[model samples]
Target chain A: MNHRRKVTVGGVIKYIVLVLVFIFLAGPLIWEISLAFKGPGDNVYAIPQYLIPKTPTVNNFVEAFHRVPMAHYFANTLVVVAINVLGNIIGCSMAGYAFGCLKFRGRGFAHGLFALAMLMPTEGLLVSTFLLVKSMGLTNTLFGVALPGMVGPLNVLLMTNAFAAVPKELIEAGKVDGANKWQRFVHICLPQVKGTITVVGILAFVASYNDFLWPLVALSDDSKYTLTLGLNRLQGTFYTDPRLVAAGACISLIPIIVFFAIFQRYLFEGLQAGGIKG
Target chain B: MARSVTQPQGRGDARNAPSARRHHRAIDDDGPSSWLFTIPAFFILLLFVFYPFLNTIRLSFTNSRMLIPGHWVGMENYVKLFQSDQFWTALLNSSLYVVCVVPFMLILPLILASLVAKGPKIIGFFRTTYYFPVVLSAVVIGLIWTNLLDSRGLINSIFQSLHWITTPIPFLTDRWLTLFSAMLVTIWEGLGYYMIIYLSALANIDPSLYEAAEIDGAGPIRQFFAITVPGVRSTMTLILFLSSASAFRVFSEVYVLTRGSGGVGGEDITMTMLIQREGTGLSARTGYASAISVVLLIIVGAITVIQQLIVRRGDD
Candidate 1:
């Protein structure tokens, strides 16, 4: 083929492939949104399933809200998210500061421990953690679900990368001015990595909010279930009812999507920013 | 944000010079305050991660169960797990998932990052669309896909209407299809996360490398292999290990989609699900579950070490 023809053909192929790929990616989601608006009697799985239902209603959503106590779940998740974010920010940056700025004994050993901690999968610790929580009478409480996730070693690794990016001169200047460690951290280090902090905050929020396993194991009571656990329950109970479950799924996902979009700039920047140090 | 001048000012105080020396010595003796500040984090991690990991190793030897103290079972649980078909099946299933899903998840994210990174102003919209799934937990994704794959659901409906198939396929109900179903949902959830990682790595790749490759008359595909892949090798290894680990630890999709029954032909229950089933109050096979968990830990640890060795060899 000639160059112009080949270019046009490639362009067409790219557009077509992109469009098809987009459809595949978004198809299930679009279908779920449609199912949420479906009426009670409609056979949601029936042949000729309407992409736009003949009789759209909010009944599924109403039933979902009543059955799941979504507000309570939301409240529980919010509290869990808040605590997790706070812990990550303080714990990670503090640890990161030690790793990045301070010369200390066994620092390499300590850093290796943090890396090993990141490598240890949560499943391996599940049973023992459950036992420990049960023993402490923390089971079935919000604290139990949120507590284990608070100080992730990965956060420390991430923040250390962020913290290390602060110029050595900055820390040295603070030291020369006779600033105490805490003062240096708060006044100098924190502001320099504010962007990293914001990124970590969003990531922590997303991870904690959508966390399923711990919340499921820790809180047996439906009243204290996070949105994730609530979604699981909704699916199990309404197995045959696609509309209600889809509605429930929509409710669970919308808040997160909204939050992420609001913080997209920070989220994107955070991903790249942490890697720059490497 | 003003730097504190108190310590130096005190050091310069001639009237209290001896006391100042003592104070400076005390401060020096205190050493790194960053370590002091991080004590809360260390304490919490020790109480949770380190202790629980040690406890898992200990508990694996005993028949611990809910509402009951475990008796020492020696290696019986491990032996039983070896003999059990269920344990092998779950192991195979999880390994298959890692093998199948890791490449797709890793490669697709790299492709996506490259494409979106090069695209114009509309990149954010495409990114948001792709990443929208990352916000949904596995349960929600499972529910939506389960419905869409049901016999009378959207997939069959569209197919049937278009005469693509004469009959509805049992997507989730069938064993082979169920694994793919899980993979589909998993890939959706995983893509955005790795995409973020790749985007970060991509940003760090010096543009001059690509420019140099371009001046050498290297095409896009050649440049991608030569420049982009090599540029992002470390990040790729990090993501690959993490993705593989995650694949091995899946529970939510299995729980929601099949509830450990393994779907139509008993092909869906992963190792984590098996442990979960046996550990719960209903069955209470704590020793058996603990053995399974220990094996899992060993498998993951082994794979991780192997991966590190392989990656390190390439680096050398």
Candidate 2:
């Protein structure tokens, strides 16, 4: 009875610690939300910080939207994300089919290349990639920003792992029924890896949406600016007032926040499925 | 675009005949058509990734400006990079950042995962909140933290209200404090990401092991170190490699917080920032940038290879 009581006490303590950890993680964003809602006259330096504002207002968000072309930036970012996500899904799925499902020569070499590509710090490739984009007359264009990330090595690897998990007999059955390799992939293998494809697609979606440095460097036009670049510019413009900048940050963050909330299960499930085992 | 081009052909094939093509396969699946599956990715990778990689290496030998080409300087770019004090400072700061950040990123998540390993379904909601920052852009995190770190910001206000300190802490300004402050931010951001990895790992462990351990009168801590840690050993290595690699490439945090310096005194400068500065600064030397990049690639690549070797060897 005493030992069981000790176990119960320890469980309570552990639960308390876990709750504190959650507080530490969620505190800043909660603070940011309060800051965003503070009106121009509210005391930001309140002696006792409050998670909720004294008099909440949407003026900061209005100012954030007014300070920059939030709509334009959102549309531009969506375009880049759409193109990159589409490219990663199609190109990576195809590459994955070849590497995972087909018994082709040079497959080992190809897989090795993908692994190496996955590890190389992309910051190292920035200068040359920028130069190449420039030389191709693609500067100030969204496509230039999207092109380099289109077929991500990591996504390709994840898709390969996903496709490999599909029963081999399915593809062989399609092949025996006169389906060519392409048909076998399109009709048979693709459906099996749909969940995984969604997993990789969502991963790519988050990345492209949040990408900053490449878009900042590759595209010089305001019209081409992504949400990060636009929000940063707004922060620069509203240097003295953090409340307005917080609003901009909230704007840029909401979509992915919504996305993760909806598909949080997929992210957890994908890891268990070994989508990133490579 | 890839779908548009490939889908129509598949439809065309389907319309032609269903039974005629059966059993008439080209003797083997390893026909010339295999290239059709791999070629699109191959082309993009060759055109963008490989071609520029070669260009970067070639440019390292020559004093190539962004727009103008110069004569090959042999090993001068590498020589200058090795001797630069700036390079040493960056190397020290980056190394310090890695030393501080990677361990926290690895272990804390395991603890949290174990803490909430089999709790009620609401753990998902808490898990989402923990992982929230991972999805947020680095720039936004930078901004949020910057607000909190300001002289009269929330942190200072709280500190003073609690009588912890009379003056506001120079969280983002002091030379010595900047990297540590950045490390704190990193720890916060990484907790959720690595937690998910560890949680998934923890889920896969046999519940029977814990039940058996309980039968032996083992406590939770002993059970963790004895079984849980060992069960997820490979995951620990994976997170270590990932966090270490990212630490070596740290940029957006420092860039946003200091508006491009470690602090007011320019105490922090990462290798990535150095490459950007050299590549695009008024000095405008692609050769130097390439050399720095090559060094970073070598260091990061070597670590990557070593980690993979360990992981692969374990598999063998």
For residue A24, give model 1's deviation from the true position in Å: 1.6
| Model 1 lDDT tens row, B28-86 | 32265547866867877888889988887877788777777778888877877889888
Per-prediction DockQ comes to 0.35, 0.39
Tens-digit per-residue lDDT, B1-316, candidate 2: 1111111111112212222333433244465567687777777787777877787888889888887877799999988888988888888888888899998988898988887677667775676677667777788888899899888888999999999999899988887677787788878877777787787678779999999999999998999999999999978987888789888888878778877655665668888888777776334788778888888888888878788788768766
Taking every candidate in turn, the Cα RMSD to the unseen true structure, in Å, is 7.7, 6.6
Please name the candidate that would achieve the greatest TM-score relative to the true structure: 2
* Deviating ranges (above 4 Å) for candidate 1: A1-7, A40-43, A269-278, B1-33, B204-236, B259-261, B264-266, B314-316
TM-score per prediction, in order, is 0.88, 0.91
Q: Across residues A1-278, which tens digit of lDDT does each residue of candidate 2 receive?
A: 23433447788888688689887888888889889999866888777677777778999898888878898999989999998889989999999887767765566567667756766678888888888888899988988888888887767766766666677678778978998777888898888788767767777787788887788778767878988888778767336788888888888778877887787866655443333221
lDDT of 1 at B192: 74
What candidate 2 gets wrong by more than 4 Å, as runs, is A1-7, A270-278, B1-28, B281-283
